[model samples]
Target: MKVNIVGAGVAGLSLAWQLVQQGVEVEMFERGTRVGEKACSWFAGGMLAPWCEAENAEPVVLEYGKESLAWWQNALGEGFVDAKGTLVFAQQRDKKELKRFARRTQAYEVVGHDVISSLEPDLASQYQEALFFKDEAHLDPRKALIRLTEVVQALGVKINFEQEIEPEDLLPEKVVDCRGYNAAKTVQSLRPVKGEMLLVKTNEISLSRPVRLLHPRIPLYVVPRDDQHFMIGATMIENGHGHQFSVRSMLELLGSAYALHSSFAEAEIIEMGVDLRPAFIDNLPRVERDNNIWRINGLYRHGYLLAPYMAKLAADSIFSDTHEIEKLADFKIKEDRV
Candidate 1:
């Protein structure tokens, strides 16, 4: 059987990879010419910290997201998953925020300044305590998407670029829509959550792993890329695709980074971006069949963290022809018409 996947973001590419592995013929349609283009996955910090995310995310996120790190290693081959872990710290005055985060999360070790210094030397002098999630990992989202496109093609899957598709217009035996925020056009319950991110480069400071800087209003994370570059983000604004970056957000982000390390004050701003991430009212993913199309979306901010598992579930649903779908509430088994 053949499957036509819409949207070449993390979800689409991941599903395509999974289906191809299951010996299914796969063809993908993407509106953008290049991978990551027009997809919010491009702006992601690439953090695989399921435990830290548990501070606000549902328990289900922890279960599925934890599996993603291993899935990515298998998908991308060895050396792709960075297992340096995640470090979370807060200002001395706002240390209560750290306590609250620790209370909500698990699989973390609370470390004092000396241990924190050994783990992240730059942060040791500034913050006296931190929560370390040792099993967490990260990857470069842009690189992963590009490599996924190549891997799928190498596996005999075809990708059609700049091809905007409507599910009804396609004649494929099966269709899987992973269109992220654009899925809102058909899925009314899916809403857009605008997120803004920034890229900066500085040789003044170095961080081995992703670090979260906790603040009362603006919580920020800095994910290190190759060289002296870091991807810092993100502001979660409800609804609307305000594509332009806000001055207030920039101030808060930069101010927070500076608070984490004064060296960030001299860091050269590289790039700034804004994209709308799709989310349900409850901020979880769903798999549902509407006619011949299987819509999988509402990843929210957990794009990299959840794509692997979502793709596996989608592949299993198609292969086994199962009806009792898990995860989200709306998923239901329908008759086989494919």
Candidate 2:
């Protein structure tokens, strides 16, 4: 079988990888000049914390996320994933928020200062207690996307960058629309959620894993990257995307980072990114089919965590001869002719 995938973001790239591995001839088109240029996954925090995400997301998210964790490791190799797990904590005054998070999530161990210190010495002085989701993991999104592109290209998948063609334009060929927010016009139910993030470099502190700092109003997570770099994010603004970061978001993110560790006050601001994440009303992902076109989107903030599984589902439906597509989607859309 031959397939064409649009939008070379995490969703498209993952599907390309999956289809190519299945011996299907795959061709990908991207509007951007290159991978990660216009992709929201480029600015993602890349947390693979299914249990941590379970605090607010649906159970399906956790289930698929856990499967995605193993999929990523197996597909990309163990070295690609930083399996140090995730840490969630709160200030003394906001201890109730920690309790609330703990109540909603599972697969974690409550740890005191000693365990906290062992996991992240920099945070030991600031936080006395935390919930450790030891099975969780993280990765650098930009690196992961680049790696996926390389893997797919090596597997003989052809990618065309700077190409902007709608799924309808590729008629008669199986098409998977992983265009994300770009498909908002046709997928009327899709909405954009603005997310702002920051990249900071601080040599004073070191962290092995991602850490979530709980607050009543603004919850923040800091994921560690190589060479004392950290990805600090993100604000779930209901407004659409903007070219610049909002002052309020910056202050909240920086303040939250400072609260997590005082050294962040002196950290060099490496980059500030703002992008619109496509999400449905339920904030869960979906795989919808309209004749020959299949749309895989609505990953929200769980791009890296869920895109792999969504891509797998898309691949499965493309090759399957039965009505198993409905069973693979988080939300079922009646099959309709375009």
Among these predictions, the greatest lDDT belongs to: 2
lDDT of 2 by residue, 133-180 (tens): 999999898989998899899999999999999999998888999999
Give candidates' CA RMSD values in order: 4.1, 3.7
* Model 2 weakest lDDT span, ten residues long: 329-338
Q: What is the lDDT of candidate 2?
A: 0.89
List pairs with backbone clashes in candidate 1. 323-333
Task: Give each model a TM-score.
Answer: 0.95, 0.95
Q: Which residue pairs show backbone clashes in model 2?
A: none
Model 1: weakest 10-residue lDDT segment is 329-338
